[model samples]
Target: MSLIRKATILRPILYLLVVCSCYGDGGGRILVFPEDGSHWINMKVILQELHARGHDLTVLRSVESWYVPQNSPLYTSVTVNPAPSSEEEDLGPDFFSDLMQRSLALRKMFPLRRFLEQQKDTMAMLLTFHGGALRVISAILDDAVLVNQLRDSRFDLMLTDPAFSAGVLLAQYLHLPMVYNVRWINAGEAHMTIAPTPPSYVPMYNSQLSDRMDILQRTENFLRYVTIYVQERLVIVPIYADLLRRHFPPGADLVSMQRSADMWLMRVDFVLEFPRPTMPNVVYVGGFQCRPAGPLPDELEAFMQSSGEHGVVVMSLGTLVSALPKEVTEAVAKAFALLPQKVVWRFLGERPAFLGNNTLLMDWLPQNDLLGHPKTRAFVAHGGTNGLYEAVYHGVPVLGLPLIFDQFDNVLRLQVRGASRVLEAGTLTTENFLEAIEDVLSNPSYRDSMQKLSRLHRDTPLAPLDSATFWIEYVIRHGGASHLRTNAYDLPWYSYYSLDVVVLLLTPCVALLWVFIFVCSRLCCSRLRRKAKQD
Candidate 1:
């Protein structure tokens, strides 16, 4: 071959190498489902971030979570299921809701044997999950990789979010590592579960601490947690069994199936928590806030700009709890009318009549973008954990009107942390709403306090995102997730539940009873002997 021909071949190969170098990198069999709206956003943010860092993102999305009531206790109300009504009754969403509500209420009251016997039809429908759970399971099973997202603690993992049991079973059968995350406030936060209102002010909230009842009121609160633990097992075990029957015919021991978890990543930071003991498995990464803002839409940007007198107060009850019922809307609108500042509320549906000229209601708003604005003063919200992070990230104060599970807890935590005030839903009238809003707005101290907490929230040695990236990369390189797991798994449920005490107590009682019987028999024998001698 001539030198001229060799040079020509090398030139083409060099050009190809340059093109390959310019176009960077390789990728995961990641399967993600955004069944919940905010959850979708959450995954999107992570997906984008990961993609930027060279990841193959596979997101299974549906309109749920932050936008709708799909993931909560109320989602099934929109579905349709039928019972064999006189061999001809057809069931609609309304019928499903009514039937579901009755059965759920009954499950609370009935013991296992009674519930199983009476709830045959309801259980059949619930297990079938014609609404959507089965479909999600099928989708997950079909995914290239199984990523069992432990976003909620349903049956300790994704094992039992009611109908989603099938999804959990599918993930397990595929040998997927359950990725645990705290999509809400840290459960380990010091007994913040106690009622928010002072015992004396219980009348205001129209409630009483369930634990405050007399002996007959039932010592259930203490036992309730343990009962729930058992109940979770009962629910998941059956579903697991059912799925195994239909699928994993080879079978798996229950203990081994339960034991399999690759890693647990906490979506919370210790700064957000009220100081309490936490296990090693519980990685404290509360700083994993939503990805920061980009450009805002033109309309949203304009809506946020106003004079000092017209302040922006963002009110959203989150996606699942979006149905603000007419009364709540009117109450909120009336409260906004009372406030001197203009309110930009991300309200769903038609605007309320009580909404004043100063108030602007829209179906959607750029949440973090609005908060990041300098004029934005305070946030009135349902106290979702993600929302709390947004407010903190922006150095804004908040008035929390919590309506459901853990919302009240988050509100109280904010109150205790001096970051916000809790506005009880029962007393959430126009006056009370304005009062709480005014308290957060007028009080420079509250703003300063929140800003202080915000500073603390961000005062890490490394940027939160950087820290998260480092740990994730380290895990991938080392491939040793066992280092992150807690010793809680090693201990038996008896030790965790302290069933040892019951055994100890029963042992002493048995010994005492035996001693009493022995002494009594000896005395009777002696008496008989004396009587015979006398004769």
Candidate 2:
């Protein structure tokens, strides 16, 4: 009788686990790459839910990802090895962190060695970079195709940092769906996808900015253009650049390799983004926030509580951006010492000489939980998109101390929207740092504004992840993605590539010049005739 009762209890618990676990992403061969720092951590929630639903999924993640998905939702990994080491030209952790910006995207028209530097300035790279290890792991993941009843690839979905675009393109050549999950700053290319002209809320792109492309953005755009046109059509050029050659191709340039993405796996809640577009393909799956946020560590919990009502400030530049000079670290240490509130900074280096007991510097921390905690008053952050979404999620006001690249833009966006405070990294006096922190923390208006924006952010009709899933399923349901197709081919380079402004400017100017030249020749001829008559 006791055994019968035990069986009954066990069966229900098993079924409940199954129900909670059923994520439903399905077994239709999906390949995902999220090469953006540890921001790949966000996908843990999405994948777990997918696995519970009994979907066959694989992850191309960091070599350090075993801890992330240790047991529950089994997924494979493929790692792109860090650049080989050398004493002559080595940039450590910071370079690797910002390598996405520095390196020409893997999919650029040029070769890898051309844009790919020998080493990045990441301490993480210095500690963990083993090319042989990554290569070995990659070789194993390469066989992901054969592991099945699934059989012969359906479509692959790649979602990674822009630096990983070359890998995305290679997968596309294998006839897989390529999608970039907005883990952090959407690369300049992806930002251009939803280019913020007039109507879009993230107004980063405009004619004004275009006129100010700073040599770097223009260079990035040019490489992208060349990739799609010249590189994709290498075998066909000049006379051979004929469209007819596409029909005669045996070992052609594989225009199929030129990936036409169906949509982006925008890991942001549409609720957060205002003035959202009404596009068919774009979907928001952001705020799949904490499936992997297993439990808060006890010391972090104790640390927050021990601070009394003074509250605590959490400082981190996300994972990738931690590589900075000792001078910057010293300035940060001095600033933290000055804060009345206890500060916990996730600095991935040794305890600086300038630091004090008021400061806590560690390699890593439970970022989201700290933000969620009641003792958390203000976030002194690097203004990463993930951090932006989190702070807004909890209604915590931020002191955005942005240092490099998109961080400036991200914080600037926050500052303009009344959602964040931006501090220039270089010129920060400790007094200035404390003033910014104190202003945001003590100012009720800043908190109130953050609260209002938080509500506005969450007002989206659909969760970002749901929208991401909808598009993902939509593509697999409709083979090869015909619906998202644009008549981009029918348009000329000036029109198709949207260089029509150049065409418009040149055409009328050339016509007027021709007219002036014709009149000048005719007048000269008449003068010569009159001179001959006089003679």
Candidate 3:
């Protein structure tokens, strides 16, 4: 063969070898600290994706964790002892059920009084929750053996849910590059922490206001924003104050440590969230957990098919609150009975007396599969983020009965987009529930709107899960993503807001104005004196 032909063959061989070598690259070892409950569900999806991509993972969970198990093929689980009398460790369906009942009662009070009482209740909850989270952090830090083992593990990065600050504290202690699987931080939404959220338009978490606001609405949002700030500073921050003082440098604070994460895998897509300022390091992996529907069990498939052309409605209240108040459940059951469509509900408590033959109750149902099925028309939901996004993924309209926490805001987003309707679970009645369901089922606009959102959500170049995994690996490859992180986190509040620069700039102008006034006054005095002397 000629020399040119030989060289061409060698080039192709070398390229093939290079491709094979890159494909076989060994994965990084990752340390994960996850929050329990629905948050763990989100984290586990990402972990599964990472595992498939050849990454090794180690997960930390509390001994009394409700969702996280001791064994999983995905990662090695390290269970830690929670603090004695830990409120979070003791949290169960019954606790949230009581809270729902209290919320319902509060809703019946006078508006102003109800607002005050709700704030008081929310503050108490925050204190208890954060206090429990702090105890877990203290437990981990207090253990010399665990701390040494963690340090010796030589992990590439810490991937954590910042809903509790335990992961943030541990990542900082280990001096690891941190990536947050976050929607909420210690105090409020993660965006409020990392982005420039102007209260003029950006609604506070739980505010339930849209991006467009009238004057009074804006005022309410502003107050809510201020309340969150106060809660964070006075309530949540102080929970970690003593720990920071003992383990961290002077002036170290929880918010700053949280903001220092190399990447924020925000679990909100713009399709579902109101437009707001965001940081570069904040990657939106919303609906990352959703996937194409799998084959349903034969019995479930038969039920779905039996609905005929009328279709089916799927309902789930999420992981935390297994069942709503008894009265509310009865109202919902009666409403479901009135629907021509078959209803599949995930109900954990006693069967409602008013339930109809059209409705089927299961302790649990295949939520994603049901939503994706062609027979599935609308979803009755508690407005949990996971379920809402899944509905969006499958283009199913939602009739939301938001009970607590961010559920209200989650449903409101879909309502604003014309994909869902919201009803106050506290005031839910058979008549109103039936009316809303009828409206959702009869209206073609709701399904059309949700389908549009699904298109936009699905049109991304890389899948949300892949995007999340890629950035995580990016941080691992580069050791950290400090270049992508903004320096604003290190700035003091005044500096971050540019208040110091404003004062500095205003000082010279103020001095000039005073000088000009003084000179005029002196001139006037001289003129007056001359006039008097001349007279």
- Candidate models: Cα lDDT each: 0.53, 0.56, 0.89
**Candidate 2 residue lDDT tens string, 94-171:** 455455433223223243353333212222232233222333234433444532322354444544433323334345
RMSD of each: 12.4, 10.6, 4.7
Q: Estimate each model's TM-score.
A: 0.65, 0.65, 0.93
Highest lDDT model number: 3
Q: Which stretches of candidate 3 lie over 4 Å from their true place?
A: 1-24, 86-90
Candidate 3 weakest ten by summed lDDT:
15-24
Clashes, model 1: 9
- Candidate no. 3 TM-score: 0.93
What number of clashing residue pairs does each candidate have, in the order they appear?
A: 9, 28, 0
Candidate 2 whole-model C-alpha lDDT, 0 to 1: 0.56
Give the lowest summed-lDDT range of ten residues in model 2: 199-208
lDDT of 3 at 104: 69
